[model samples]
Target: MTTFYAGLLSPCALACAVALALTGTAHADDNADKNTHTLTPVVVTATMQDSPLIVVTDPKQPRQPVPASDGADFLKSIPGFSTIRKGGSNGDPLLRGMSGSRLNILVDGGMIAGGCPSRMDPPTAYIAPQLYDRVTLIKGPETVLYGPGNSAGVVLFDRNFERYTQPTLSGDASLLFGSAGRSDQNLDLRAGDSTGYIGISTNHTHSQDYKDGDGNRVHSQYDRWNADATIGWTPSDQTRIELTVGKGNGDAAYAFSRMDGVQFLRESTALKWTQEHLTTHWEKLEVQAYTNYADHVMDNYTLRTPDPASMMPMAMAADVDRRTSGGRATGTWRWGDALELQAGVDGSVSVHTHRAGGPPGSMMGYYKDQPRMRDARMQDIGIFAETRWSFAQSQRLVTGVRVDRVQTRGYTLEDMAGMEHMESMSGVDAMAMMPAQTAADRGDTLPSGFVRYESDLSRSPTTFYAGMGHVERFPDYWELFGQHVEGTLDSFRALQPERTTQWDIGMQYHGDRVKAWVSAYAGVVNDFILMHYPMTSMGVDYASNVQARIAGGEAGANYDFTSHWKADVTVSYAWGENLTENRPLPQMPPFEARWGLTYEATQWSIGALWRLATAQHRVADDEGNIVGQDLGPSAGFGVFSFNGAYRIDRRFTLSAGIDNLFNKTYAEHVNAAAASLAGYVNTTRVNEPGRTLWIKLDAKL
Candidate 1:
């Protein structure tokens, strides 16, 4: 398996091929014909519309081979997505070499960000994929319909409520068990009649520390639970209104950090109204409003015993919270079925605050005596419009434009006991705050848009398209308030907005025996955000802006050699350079590819998957995104896995898989270094899990 993964495709060739694999997934054909009903482990990638690539998948379906514990783990199955591993769960996701706010992640049209300045919990960490109906990824600065930034891309976890003409009850439930004390249970139940409906979903997962391929334990354990409900009313055939409420809480242990998350609380609410088949030229209308909150608590003693001799030799804890609220209104129009238009206005506002205490023993519980310090406030309002015009029999033009008002403010900083920001670790203000005794506010007017052209070949089953886009991104909380910039910043006003211009193109081909696609992009960026770690030997990782250039793409193909036999191949690659310093941009990963072979039968099926990565030589010491920095070049590695599934009647299915068949000890290049724990003093990339077996049972009604 290693020989096949490492030798079938050359590093340089693989990168080039993936750049042309425009759709980035072998399931493009399946996505095009959505009416078909089939079961697969998961659908990681796909293409939609005429511009860019949007990999869409039904979250209710059980993917084969691997089942992820969180959003980031699931996304890594797709090309162009990687994660910074701190442990088994809560790994921060990176896209096309970009992390943090540049990706524009949204949950049910609302934003909820964790408060750890070090990014211990990114938006993806809080997501439970099974709770949502669909996951959509829009690669690069492809479109303006979602929101701002998107230099890396846009990720959307959404839910769809379908109305019924008669009373009906439906949903799915599943149970999963795996190695390292892994276990999970999930249920999604919904019931309703023609006029109204109600739906509910709940999930629970728990695991203990897992051993690596070498039989050495790693501090990667977690416990979590989530529940949500939706109520909808269908007053008429063309009108519907829905309301949703959700709550979740969890705790986790990490191997590389001094603190563990003792509490992760999430609360959310949303309301949406839709009216279709409107009068005149109006096609539809949608209006929505939502609010999301995150309350997190981290401590050194809650999940692990204190290391008396370590740097953090005592127990410490911190409490932080953030709240975000947003609203959107949109209208759809059509002209003779040849042209379609969508226009809308969207806005969001967020507030962040924190309090910390501890050291010799433990901090005051409940942050009762500590003073609440309001540190960050952000707001955005935008107007956008997009159109699709079929100007010719086999050609179409797609374009969109958006304008936004962005603002950010930082207030007085003081922890419990009246400690100042620069004098304590409250903000992880290790480097120091922007010296703001009084609140400081900054705002900007930003513009972004994209245009795409597509053509369908009449003589062949194929399609082709190209697009170009430009986007201006406002600096996020971590970039502006999380760190300092010496004499140039303190009100942190020196940071500039990120500007990007890129070109994208791709094509897809479908045939009875052959299915394939290629996608590629190249772009230039101005004032790109770069996190410089340990600036001035003060242990501060601060944000800096510099010019840069980037290019890369993904490609894949599948062939059915026989009625019951099939082969699939996929590759992904990315390249970047710091124009100002002429060095390779930090944290860029090496070539990666996946190969799979499978056989299908009447009641059962089996498959094998091989994942490979090339050794990376490019390095920019101590430079990367907010989550982590590049340690150095990493060695290449590969792993082989196998899976099988059987239908146990009409309503139930059983599936099992063995990962890392050889128990090969390997680590990913884009990962955190080993912690300096007492017994585990070595500092190398954290090894992946050893050979393990997993089984899952899926049931639906």
Candidate 2:
């Protein structure tokens, strides 16, 4: 470990020295450039709209959002994005009241599956935020061309090659230090000319156990590293091709879980082609292809001592590996004065294999004894089109439609252990029945459509829009396999697909000193997939189809005062009910509000934020028996944080902040508790981290 740390730091230190030397010589040039031009606001890809630095389109963005400590941490900043927090890093994302397979998460256009049936190494855990250029999120069922049945939405964390018209070389380096002995270092390098470009990025981060609000040392330590490179070629004015490859690995310990995360690794590759034509009616065309591979392993006795009575005692281990390959082709056409259209077709195929077993204490022993659970394959294909038309100067219409086809197959193995367990329990010398091996297949076709009308207020700086959409979603993997059920193999016996009809309305107001936006939506679902658990046989849970209705809205505003002081506030609320039972739906996020105040100057800025949540009492009567059940109404709480940043020069800057100012302890309603253990029974909701302080230094050349 010491040698690895030294190797990573040595190059960074040398690069920093070189950057400092160059900064001294480049100061005059930078000063003249800065004096002649103004800086452009940094825009995020989460929404199509452009916003200023301090404004967040997603309601979930907060300074420290429960001490993220990883990629999942940074993602929760978006509105409607939550996580199944189980202490520290590697939390699973839950978006817009949906979770697990319902949400499609991609890193650099690659899909990585986790190893743990409990989802310890969520896909997001393999991603290194510092390596990506942009993180884009599409909420709800608005866009399905990106991947398979993304009922919740799509999250694209991407890194793009630098575009240049002339020969150029650039790079940036950063170092971060924080409480709990946390440290991180990153480097980004790019070199390009008129005809091509090449780039590379790498980062490493580590942290020790952190103390929570109650001054207890939480067993949450992690170490991670990543490196990737890309090359692009542009042979002509309107044609370009790019290729990329990357790899990453890490290990971490969970404070709330009984076992430590032993090993995580990922490899990915992608190719993209873009072309623009001047003679044809089609203005542009884009095509992309990519393949991703993930290998993961988890053990009970790797990082910590294992409990004797635990299921995974004596170094029990499990492994899961998955591969995904897919591509898409898109085209845009312009017709007449007020009409334009864009169309695309995309698809992907993924296969996963899981293996477990081993000798009592040997690494290979676990694999020798355990039989394979199942091998699964999934494929999806979709075609989509969108059009924009201008009815008048102040009014416009946007419409889109998509059709998708999905197929899934799983091969089951003979249950040798199941027969043995049954014979042992019977207590009589009886012959074990042989179960036949079988294969299950499922296929479905779904359609989605949306239409919207937008207009600018007659005489004010206000824009308002109303939209309606219908989306049909295929049931996801978790709903199919995670839940316990019989005869699921029969297509007719499977849970029905979820269909949603929804309406959305929103308004935006932009002024010289104030900016505000509000949006509301209502959705009705036919055959919504709901998980139910029974208390029989030591507790069992399963998913079933049910009719449901859901409605929600979000509002946010920011105001600037006296050039240095500013205030911002945002709020969100959601409600859901099962129509058949006439009761509240499960796992609904409570109403919440966030307020912020900040002061700024040319070289420095400071800010503070306050977060508040309303107590929730609404819960489905049959929702608490599942693994992640809503434990009834939850109490509300408030938290505060402070942040600051300073620019030492054009080439250098520093940022620092303290999160959870008061170290208040609280739990989110959607979080899941760790699985029960023999000696450590943790049935309560997952607890959040305590206060943390951090400082970061950044430099560019």
Candidate 3:
């Protein structure tokens, strides 16, 4: 072991490390089923990169260090995913090397749009992982059953309140306490008779600012809560209908932005119906409708005292809201023993509004001067078809296609502070970039599709596959309307749609005592949308189109030795470049790997994990996403951690862990620099949390 490793092993020096995603180390008894037990290491069931890629798993299980606090935090456990951290919670997710609208996310098959133009609340921010029954990640632009604008990938969070054969009652709950005033509580209760049922799920989390390995406060504090209820009617064994309602609220302080979110309120409602076995050929049918709304408030004085010596020396606040509604219908068909098909049509419409004002000794008077303004509205309609063909017992082929029509309307605020800040320009066509006086509208048609082939090894428990896919995405509201340059051009009017063509391949193997998988992908993008960091123009980044190529892969392996010992390893890497500019793609994460070891017994388990990253010398300064631009280069780092658990009974389990065993101060490459306390322009990315300890209890009945 190197000096660093040696130090990490020492109890006194165990100080730093946290991406919150530790190794899914195996700590199972001889007969523990990987899927049912939350205490065992999480298994990564891989598929070909081109396989319309879907990885489905129970989101309620405990894995790695512990359960995630939010959707973005939960994604870190998956391959080819990372987060743009703002604090302990509410990090924005990044897939491959893409951010923003590139990653389309849906909750219970519904779109929940964030109100912040700066992404203070990403789609995932509203998520409480433990409340969802299942989490699925579909990589690449392979399939488009979901609404348009997902050139990078799609994420789905769902809960299936299954009916009961007879009268039944069940529920699960968990409680957690950790360092730095960390605490969490979650509960899920369900009951149903053959005819109907009602259920509810709720969760809460709170934490204070945590210190870095060097004992420096990171300026991150947050508290949040979410609650949801569902009612279902089972007309017959083959038919069902359900209605769901949910509400969430929270407040958070961030070191990265000038202001903090004083309020994040969310509301959602959905109704769905399903029918099964209509005919031998038609296996099932499903219909769904939903509405989601988000209201947010950001202020310099509410979460933290405003620095009188800094920019906007006076207190300021902004309130923004977004409303979205959509519906979908899908049918599943089976043809003989050789084919199965699913076809669906879905659509969504969204509208945004904003208001802002400042400085009054009396807080009640500030809002009187702020006027709410309508900004943007968008609607999309899509139809999709997917099928699987089985030519042989061991071979299969999967294919899918989709087309989407989208329309966008904008009411550009001409008298806004940013618009009036710098209206003059020396270069570029300015007038052509401006929108219509009152409102503007644009429309486009997009198409996406994918195909894949898979075959099982004739002699082993193994599978391999290869596939190709193409996707065209329309410009999103942020890409087109949020990014504006001084006198040069309105990026919204200048930015072009993005088109991507890609190939993916990979393999998976399972043995008596070992399991492994590998996946890789490469793609070429035409008019790739790129966002440059904020410059002299204002606080907003500039979006432009450029030709680009991207490649990446992820691999993992696990082995069990005897009944008491097990080991696992995983690695992920991503690469990209702007072919038009001949420069490395900005905001790419460095090559990373993780190793873990565990010991287990009938009632107790212990484990350790070491996370490692390669130095990223790759640089493309002043260019990146809305959250951050690449800041030259960052050094590699490794952090160690330890965990243990005890099962009290079939209904209860207790676990605890020490993260960043050797509090080694480190920062990720994909991060935004946080502002300092003195109101100074601190562009240095915030350091991750240092050594921390936590304990949790899981119970069910």
Candidate 4:
């Protein structure tokens, strides 16, 4: 396996180059105590507003953007995020404009499911952003207490690991070098005292094949690894107990399908406990539980090469695994001048298994398979409630409700030519001539609601809110085992269950250097699972389900021009309609803008960013739902990035950047589709990568 990943990257790059050359002379009285620890003005975790981080509170915040190389490039800098690219680091995240399973991503709150179906391990590529520390995002469906179906909203990548006071110990480490031959490394550690604490983290990323913007190459190579550990216990001061363990693996190479991506493994374990009793009658109470595991494998000779009409051609292999477990408990109540209450109950269970055989070459190689299909289970149960009322104190009222019960079961112990060779080995030939039934079951009971209204216009610093939400979703697992034609199997058996009714409004303003925010939304969906791709045969691409209607809004602004300079701007737009072929609404996401400028002193800082996009003619011209080619419209581009950071003291810091500075080439209008190699043809638009530079280092003791 590439020499065991080059023997773990040659001693972690020779121990981070001998700790950056013996910490490169840092200590002039620790740079005067790191010049009195500066650089703490960057807040705005998706609005709860508190200015500083260069303003720009909404429009899906992302002002001085262009610093993300993953997590869909930092959620495409907010504003109803958007991504579907199929190159350079598993992209996939589309909000407000929805995408797969309707958003709802969490880490440190569990739930990570992505077993390709052409998704390619997206769950933010198994996270690993230096072990998280905040990345909240809540767009459409506002709030639903982290659990439940999210109509494109809710993305939390939190990680706190409290920092104790006594017997303390800190940690930090990072290294990154980029451009076509990118590289990454990270480490984090923590030890505690004052009652409890423990932590550990690890990460490594690699890249090789990259060349676009006309340079060609493309087939994007990749390698990944992740490790995690956590232990916590706090006996007093509002109790806490936690235990977590994690594992990850990776491989990739797919310039657009025909099988590649050898294996991707993931394992997770979690245990949690929390308590906060402030007496005075039901002040607080909370609890949680979790478990997860996933194992996946794909082959066509591990990362490309053999393609004799792939089904693993001269050599093929396949495997899929799944295991999920969950739990949750909660309670809260407070009354001192109105109401406040919260209640919770959660549940989850998932199990799946699949297997395959190999051989066609290597002298008739070896073969032994059984598990061609049949083994699935799903379950979910929920009960939730939320309330907040203060009908006076500047008007306030929030409400919530939830109820869930979902179930699914399947069993058919291999037969029918191993379920028609596992549906022709994933090319999914309309479910390889169905009729191999043996067992099946299903059940549902879903409901959700929301209401909100807030005010703070009184003292005029501006703050306003309005909300209404309703969601009823069910039918996941890639909409029931990766959509197998027949009009999504009659829209999954006469569809029904996917109701959304939304209306949100927002406003925020802060003074003392200017900060701003604006949010707007409008939704109405009923049985809207929209995904239609007709015109079949030879060009194969079938997916069905219709009935849709969508709208959008986003805006942002910021200005400081002083405190060492600052400026920001943002904008986003979305639209959809397809009331049964009425038109427009095939992977939305267009009309975008972002601007930035920054410069700080006291340590060092510099920044610049600009991005603009527009041009997409909304398409879907049948071809069995065309999987590639015939992407009618697309044109519009702009890109620029630059960053610098310094602060080599109180621990250490240094960051550098350069991204597509002038490389400009672009493509992304919900990209995906680019393989058909025979001189490679098949472009469903997705090519962007050229001109790159990077450097990052951070250390703390």
Candidate 5:
């Protein structure tokens, strides 16, 4: 596999060759207390607002235009997030204007189901946000304790394992170098006592093929790797148990596809349990279980070459897989400080499969020697409850409820030749045959909820909130077996089940040099699940149900006007409509903004950023929602960047940046379009990238 991803670009020399092949260790600590600690001067733009529509980021610090090998480029550094660009990495993430499964992404809370069907791997493309350590976002659809349609909200990439105070060892590492021949590496380690602990992490990234600002080029290249492990026990001090495992793989190169993804592969495992103060109001109890899998492959011969005017001109390949499994349990209660509670039950299930191979040239392992077939299967089960009530003296109220039972099953008509070879291995143009069915079960019973109210103003450090939510989504799996319905023989028993109902309001502020926030929302969906696409290329691809309307907002701030100067700002907006065809709304995303400045010095820092965006002429252009669509009206731009950091102590730190510092050639309006590759330069969507530079280094122990 390219020499194991080119030796993972030296993750501290593979963690010192796995610590000298296990145990022939070396130790040396205490270099004057690790240089008297002092760090935290990088994170170019992540407006941090941890309340009022929450957003908490910190994936091991280090941000700025790069650093984010995935998880949709670390959620586009936050501000109502946006992505759909399918080039440099897997892209696909949009919140506010909502996208796929109404945005609920969890990792560590388990759920990784992406087996193409034209999504080309999403679920944050198998995540790898610096091997996760915290990233929470909750906006809109308030909360129902994760899972089950988020109505454009919910994101968690958590990981926190503590309890090990006596015999210990810690770790961290990083390296990067960017701009076209980008590179990355990371490492993390841990060891323990206090009854247990063990952790490990690994990462790698690669890039090449980037050019834009009219300097053409653009077939985007990529490479990736990951490794993970965790084990915990902590036998006392309130009990605990944990386990985790992971694996990852990658390949990418797509100028908006026509095949190329050459496999993604991933596998995961999880288990957890906890008990804390277990009585006095039954104060805590939890449990979890999980499994995740994704195995994808796409090909037009590794990474392109076969466009001799499209339509299967040569070799081909397709392979898909999904597994997914789930479990959850929760309990917590309290009353002393007024109130608190949480109750839970959760579930999941998935199973999809596919297979296909070549047209000539034996295509290497020919779809790994074919034979997968299984079509579909999905599942969900739920029960939840949440609460918090601090009645007066600063007021508070928060609530939640959930109930679910969703299902889907398909595969008969003898699998219709594996769904016509999985829609002729996705280069589209083929899919209209399957009219003798009997094997497409479906079911539903969803219900979600939310409610909120809070106040803490007495004299202002500000905090005020308002909320309301409702969800009822269940039709995923690419809106039921990936598109094409009109004379349906089962777009999985004919789509349905969308239903959102939202309203959210916000406010938050924390003083001493200022911090601020604002949020807003509005919703009403009712069966909204659109997707249509097929103005030619053999025409076909549909899926319906309408009546929509959505609203958006996001705002941010940070000030510090001088203690080394600082400033920040943010804004975001989204709007949608299709009130059953009244128009406007199809990949909506426009009106964005950002600005920042910084100087700080205690260990050095410097920063700047700009980024505007605003031309999106609202047009349903072939609609959208399942990875992408609506590639029409769009044009707006602005870009600037800068960065610097140093903290060459506390075990090291160094950062750098310069992304599109001026070579702007924008393009992003719900991207993905630009396919006519055979030497690249097809542009319509896929542009952004030019004037880049990077550097990074970090270490700790």
Candidate 6:
């Protein structure tokens, strides 16, 4: 081991190594074929990268620290990703220290926007990771093929449906039981013939409040479920059509909010068609349309008793809903064997509405009866083209460009008193405090593009890549209409669009017994929209554009010491500077590292993972995005975990794990501050769950 690796070997990590060694390593069969690859039953570290810029992972695979419940949970397994912890679930996902619309999250090529103005329900909250076939992440602003303004990156949750030649029925099911009353059930089934196929998927998960290391209960509990169906027609080898429909509902209790999420309802549908080999040069053409809806409700009295000493010392409820519908059509063409091009046009429209009833008790029963009023509307239309050219035998050039016309309209009426009340309740002035009765509609034309070069080394099994990308992003609903300027009421007209120019470079190495990759990025952001929260009751909240600088890198390596034993390590770090403020950007994640060791045989596997994080001292207090603000400097901590999986037969498998093996209590730096709720202890930040034991059973048919 290198000296740097020796320096990182803490006592907890040593203990993990000792424990794993004492348990004995798996025995490899000498009669088995040496070239036949075996999948690790338990994934302990970061998933492997498919390329220098792309990461692909199986969402159905069993991973350490228990399987994920939401999209944010699943993304955390990848380096350069973190979650803004908001209780147990429904937390916002951050990539390379950026949140909100900067990170474009797409489900099966469709976008879904959350309804809550407070961000109680983010886009990933409605996603159940296990239901998807695969998750793909494109790091940095390296591509414009998807939607616009993906300055941070793009995460895609997709499913694949292959044509069946004969009649077939296939399915997979899983059941889980864990400590703290956690349980989950999932089923995915498909029946198909040569002409058509039908597929159904369902999932339900529930968890009770869990205690921290000190046996203190953290108000983090949730119940969620989802059901989806798909119908596909494969008339020929070159033609395919698919239709999908899905819906889900859930409720969650939060330790970082005064109100609890009482209801989270989602409805979605999509239609897709594709034709391949249309002409000599035309490779394929595809068209897709999708619509998604979210209905979210938050209340103070539904999950727990109202805190009498808080700002809102009475029963209150706010219901908000958003409907987003969009469509895209793209054509792919290839020229001989040297070049390929893809072009597409896409558009979307979103409408947001809300209704609320409040006070001590009078509005409790009538809240749902009140009619909802439209609050805001947003629209986008974009055209994009991407191309790849194989100029040399070992070198390739890739480039893309996109242009989008974005528009927004606000419906909030001028209400000074209501604004003051909202400030007292949420510590932020709302859009109702507009200077005019209603803000005029605003629109902007933005452009984004990127260029990259990739090459394979002559003698080494390594690929080197470098890229530069630029993106112009318009202000979203929360930045434009949801917040006010410090002393100005015309925030809608004051916030300017943000522009980012970034450079990303990386290299990947694939060897006979070792695999490794490293990626790094740096960017200069002009007009970076930042939100400032109130420090006291007399203070006011505001949003302003500022200059910023960001840089980060992630590296991981896997080594197979022997036929059955393997070791892996990963490290990630991100840094940001607010040039306008001349201070560190708020909510930047701290330096983190993970060490994993595993032993695998033909039928079973055992693994150990030790995660470490460095304390963050560079923070701009009270400044951040819509998800959360930095409270102050946070202390760092480490956690250790162990997992094991056994394959009983081809039809069934069992997996189990002990998370936080030492029962260490810790909180993440990029996290929401704890709120003063009625029953929960008021901590600086919401702590993670204590030691947890869980078991899972998977069956394939």
lDDT of each: 0.78, 0.69, 0.78, 0.66, 0.80, 0.85
Q: Assess every candidate by TM-score.
A: 0.89, 0.88, 0.89, 0.31, 0.33, 0.91
Model 2 ranges with Cα > 4 A deviation: 1-69, 108-115, 278-280, 309-311, 358-374, 413-431, 483-493, 535-537, 621-627, 675-683
Clashes of 3: 10
Clashing pairs in model 6, backbone N/Cα/C closer than 3 A: none
Predicted structure 4: clash tally: 6
lDDT (tens digit, per residue) of candidate 6 on 542-600: 88899999999999999999999999999999999999989999989999999999999
Candidate 4: tens digits of C-alpha lDDT, residues 1-701 = 34533443453653564364335424323545534755532212222333211122222122233333456666666666777666667677787567766777777887777665556666776776556766767666656677777876777776787637689766666666777777766666678897999887666777887776667777777787777778899877688888887777777776767666666777787887877766785777767677777677766676666866645456666677777788788788888868988888887887776666664445544333444454667788888888889889777888888888887765632224344455446556656655454555677888887887878788778778888888877767655555333323233455456888888877878778887877777787777764444445554343445667788877777788888887777787888777877877666768887777777776777777777888878765441112232355778788877777776555556777776678766777767767665445345566877677777666656
Query: Across residues 1-701, which tens digit of lDDT does each residue of candidate 3 receive?
Result: 13433333232222111000111111222234534544443222221132226667676665665534689878876767878888888888998868888899899989997888778888888999889888888887767677776767899998877778999877767777898898777777789999999987777788998788888888788888777889999978898999998888888888887789888888899999999999989999999999999999888987788888778577888888999999999999999879999999999999998888765654545753777888889899999999989989989998999999988887763423244423584335444444334566777898889998999999998889888989888877666555332212344456678999989888888788988888889999999988777556556556788999999988877788987888888888999999988999899999988888888877778888888889998878888876678877989999888888887644567778888889888888888777776633244887788898888776665
Root-mean-square deviation (CA) per prediction: 10.1, 4.6, 8.6, 25.0, 24.9, 9.2
In model 3, the worst 10-residue window by lDDT is 17-26
After TM-score superposition, the amount by which residue 255's alpha carbon in candidate 1 deviates from its true location, in angstroms, is: 1.7
Worst 10 residues of 5 by lDDT: 21-30
Which order, best to worst by lDDT?
Answer: 6, 5, 3, 1, 2, 4
Which candidate leads in lDDT? 6
* Number of the predicted model whose TM-score against the real structure is largest: 6
| lDDT, candidate 5, 185-275, per-residue tens | 7777788989989988877788988898878989888887788788899988798899987778878888887888877878788988888
Per-residue lDDT over 1-701 for candidate 2, one digit per residue giving the tens place of the 0 to 100 score: 33443454354553464455346435644755565422221112122222211122321122343234456777766556667776567877776566766678877666665645567777888887766767777655555446655655678777766458899878766667888888776777788897999987767778887766776655667877777778999887788899987777778877556676767777788898888885457888888898887777776666667777666567666777777788888888887658878899988887777787543657566563666565667788889998878879978787889988988776762333355455455445344345555677888898888788889888988888888877887765555554333323542236888888877788888889988887777888899888775646666566777888988876777788878787878777878889987888888878878787777777777777787888888876446312356766788989888888776666666777887889987778777655554433254666666788888766666
- At residue 255, candidate 3 shows an lDDT of 84
Residue 172 shift from truth in candidate 1, angstroms: 0.1
